[model samples]
Target: MDTAEPTTVGIINRENWIGALPAPVREAIEARMTRFTVAPGMPVKRAGEAATRIFQVETGFLSLIGLHVDGRQALITIYAAGNCFSETAMIVRREHNHTTIALTPAVVRQLERDDFWELYHRHPEIPEALCRKFAEAISRQMASREQRATQRLGQRIATMFANLAEHAGESVVGGETRILLPITQSNIADIFDVTRQSVHREVSHLKQLGIVDKRHGDWVVIDSERLRQICSY
Candidate 1:
């Protein structure tokens, strides 16, 4: 599937540093920001790269990935439009631990580390906004870790689908919720830390139970509430 360019798209959720800033500050920052347009499947940043800049999603989605010594790749997380990345890395002056890529064609806004800090110190509200954003990120990370540790494979898949629906779902003709993200079976296996066969079984079970359908290269949740219930809501 092709992703629209950032210039052709608009922000959806307002969850990033850009949106968090007070209006005047946001405008000033935006004036100095540099925009990058990434094509679908493009590599935005790689592991062990210097953290020279902080990034905010202006349009489209990105995936965070980790590589193991055994040559295995893991999917750490997905970031949608209105999300921020690399702030912690920039602050700590460390290389990035994960590789980030465009999950679809994307437009991202970048600020030099020095520029970001200048704003951070100049505006009192900057730290407050960043604190809230980071706090929420940490909370979600902890919750996701806990859930993955305790939940069964099926339940975990359900939870993942439910979360995706909440973040990126769209209404369909028959009251179903559709997610346009391209999630392959291999990706699911990586996320669940399971085998491809296991993913196939669980996905097939979901399809058999009338919970989800694959149509037009995307996933449609036919009964989102039921899926949420399976995830323990």
Candidate 2:
């Protein structure tokens, strides 16, 4: 658990789900949210814990990790700044299905389940908006699964980098896109259920082609158009 101090202001971001709400509703929700900071590698929520709050990332990256009965763990997904998650569990009144850990120093805002319901009751648009968000999320997950199932290893790796660049990349000098998050070959291997060496091979090939490179420990998409062409199926 994080013991960081919590604040009540500056919680709304137009990019996040909460910002889609009506102005009055956004203010109400913000009033109920508590923003706090989390250190890298710290657990935000763990499996089997009651889903008492819904979280929105303000900054940094968080990885959702799922565990298998045989003691194996898999990376479900990574959430970046301006993303909201864990609503499904809270809505269903069930325990969290996965563990969320900070991949970098993060700032997050959480709204308690009871407060969420209060707002839900008052605002009719809330559920409809959430339904649309859930649908989009499911569509992305299905596409990712399909890619993993049918795409060649190199294509899969390329596609992964392209998607990550969209989600976490920032434009830099020379038109390159730098993925701000710390992603490793091992993390890619976990996502595709492949060995780290295999992921390294694909990454090295991309590096050799000058489609991607690393700068200051972050992955940089040197040639975004070329990467897209490679990932196109």
Candidate 3:
């Protein structure tokens, strides 16, 4: 996490930003780009730190978390593989809004704030894409906040499962079946803004109703389409 060496997002060398740009322009940006490899449980940036760099994730998950006044953290959002975080930090050139933490071993590419501004000036389309991306982030945050404020515990929990399925789920060979939730119930509770005990009880209810079938280890899936229909409404 020490921003000292350049190897932040090790595998990010392959990301394509300006495919239509002339060769020289792309070369200029890539020359200044740097990558790094970081381990799990490392802090990428702390709250209130000067936003020195924008981070693009090559692989793994990153958490944007708000630490409560009582010292506990409420995870606000998760950035997955190929998505970029900390971009707005450079856009505003201000302090970080939330702490960024790696959930697993990850690669993060860094672009200095000044370098980003330079790139934006030369390639206007890049800035437009970044603007749209930031807007989407804000909209997602607003939706999550609204859902947390108005939804019931069961609904929020179900929404969490759906979000995970959208981002991380993989299809099993069982004829179009998909699986992505490898997290324990407690971790799922943390993600859903609920108590672990609540998740345990609700999971029991899901099992009883045949909404989810728990397999060996952390594997679980919906064997029936009825699960999705009931949870969605």
Candidate 4:
């Protein structure tokens, strides 16, 4: 078991780290972690701000973003639960690498790089936790990345919906599969390396084709099997 020390009363949830690591390593990290939460649209890191901590999302989503000279920001990554981030700032403060924004009400556990390294050295498994989680759903992420890279906007959207059904989709009342797309259009653009207007038009096209539906800020896939056959994810 990790033998560092007792955890702080209200820092990171000890359970999460313990769950991610072997017993001993978990104990090591539990001694030096802290936790915090953020609301939707809040900045996790500001432009030109220093990077100081790394975070793992426990719930909801975070957007890694870069700003253009004109003060407009483009999404870079939409990080979901179990993803680690802010490594650049955690070890040494540098100019803000990217602006991180909360895409929804979110809970996160964080540690300064120094503390993180201390724990990481003791627990080799911590670094792999994100990969482990992603691996659990590898087929889906692979198909998604493939679509993002090789497919046109329409095909990307279609394959995404299809993959969701097999990966995270749930059956609805009419025996149709629904997958939640909690990400923003800007972030979708980032995934496909396309313009936001392009994504907007493609999404509109998908809607018209009855491939999916949006509800309460989430995209629910409607005809995933058909979508897969046609889109070829």
Candidate 5:
């Protein structure tokens, strides 16, 4: 990874954590941030490593991987641009519980643990923003657990794609929406706690229905409404 000095302008905006802060507070936080770039397939932070910093993704996608004692790895989640993460580790003063790996060439900004506390104490808005972020994460976690418990395999898969299209999709030609992240069948399988073959079958079904397809190696939602309808049922 190559590190860069802080810039005068702040990158935080209303879309992400700490972005909703006042301009001066955002600038103050940005002043303490150091930017870095990571190559695809590189580990941004490893499990068991000291968590002395909080990170915000400026570009590209990252995978949060959870490792078990049985030597198994699971995809916990994906972090895209404008997402901030690792705050829990920093807050609890614990080592990272999961590994973060870059899925594509990514630019990230990190604020040291010490600087983070200083800002937290100095700015009242910081804690409020963090609380909101944590709440959102918890809500998503609960929804995911519910989804895994109550939904069928195919329904879960469709719901995952629909959620991705809403959160991380870019409009493409011909009314299609392409998922911005470079995700694989294995990744989807990991997220759903299912086998890759199972995911492949569901993906094939979606393709046959003309609801989704791959274009230029990216997953495209051909009919967003139809995909959502699949999720609804």
Candidate 6:
């Protein structure tokens, strides 16, 4: 997709790196930052590229894709609005480890490495806040790993759904939680290390249990309580 000027979605989350900055500091940093828009399926950063900037999603979603040894793609992670990514690579001055792509039309703000460090030096709290954030991320990763190793297939699928619903789902008129992101059987297969057919069967089971439903080419949580109880991992 092509880039365009930033759209107006005022900052909502105060915990992010940019949001944490004091008003004047934020203004100074915003003066140097570049805000742009991208269309769905557009490439953000390719794997092995020098990580010169970290991206914050003002709106829309980006999926991180990792290349498997067998020439396959794996969904490494998902970043939606209010999320900051590629900071680790920027910190270490290393290449991007995974390719990042827009999952929907996106408004993104990018901060260059030098600018990021400059902000850090300007505010001593920045590094501590960032460290806490990364620590939380690491904790989530550890929990996810544990769940993947021990959970049943159906439970794993349910957990994935629950996570998406919490992190990216939208509320509809009928009170159902709708996940607008593009998720396919192939994506699930790659994420859970299962076959496509297995994902299909598990999805069907979820439908049968009334835990989830398909709507408008996306998935919806029909009974979040049941889903949470069954897949509390």
Best by lDDT: 5
Please list the residue runs of candidate 6 whose C-alpha ends up more than 4 Å from where it truly belongs after superposition.
Answer: 1-15, 21-27
TM-scores for all predictions: 0.86, 0.84, 0.74, 0.68, 0.85, 0.84
List runs of model 1 lying over 4 Å from the truth.
Answer: 1-14
Q: lDDT of candidate 6 vs native? A: 0.78
What would the per-residue lDDT of candidate 1 be over residues 1-233, giving only the tens digit for each residue? 11211211111223565675668988877777899999988888899999988888888888888886898888877878777789888878899999999988899989888898898898888788777767766766676668777888898888778767766789988889998688888888887778999999999999999999899899899998789789774
Q: lDDT tens string, model 5, 132-220?
A: 77776676667667777888889888877886787678897888999877778987787777889999999999999999998889999
Q: Which ten residues in a row have the lowest lDDT in candidate 2?
A: 2-11
Predictions: Cα RMSD each: 5.7, 6.7, 7.2, 7.8, 6.3, 6.1
lDDT of candidate 2 over 113-175, digit per residue (tens)? 899999988888788768867776666667666766788999878877887787677999999
TM value for model 3? 0.74
Candidate 6 local lDDT, residue 209: 88
TM value for model 4: 0.68
Q: Which window of 10 residues has the lowest lDDT sum in candidate 5?
A: 5-14
Model 6 per-residue lDDT tens digits across residues 1-233:
11222211111111255566566766676677799998998989999999989888888888889887998888866776767788889888899988989989999999888888988788776677678767766766676777777889888888778878876789987778998888888888888888999999999989998889997798999988999898764
Indicate whether candidate 1 or candidate 3 has the larger TM-score.
Answer: 1
Q: Estimate, for each residue in 17-87, the C-alpha lDDT of model 4 and write its tens digit.
A: 33556767665665576778899989877768766666767676677788667877776656656556666
Residues 1-233 of candidate 3: C-alpha lDDT, one tens digit per residue: 21112111111112223333456765565567798877877888899999987776767777667876898776666666655667777777889989988866888777787897888898776786666555655665677667667776776666555546555656666633354434567566667657889989877877787666567654455653655565566
The lDDT of model 5 is 0.80
Candidate 1 weakest lDDT stretch, 10 residues: 1-10
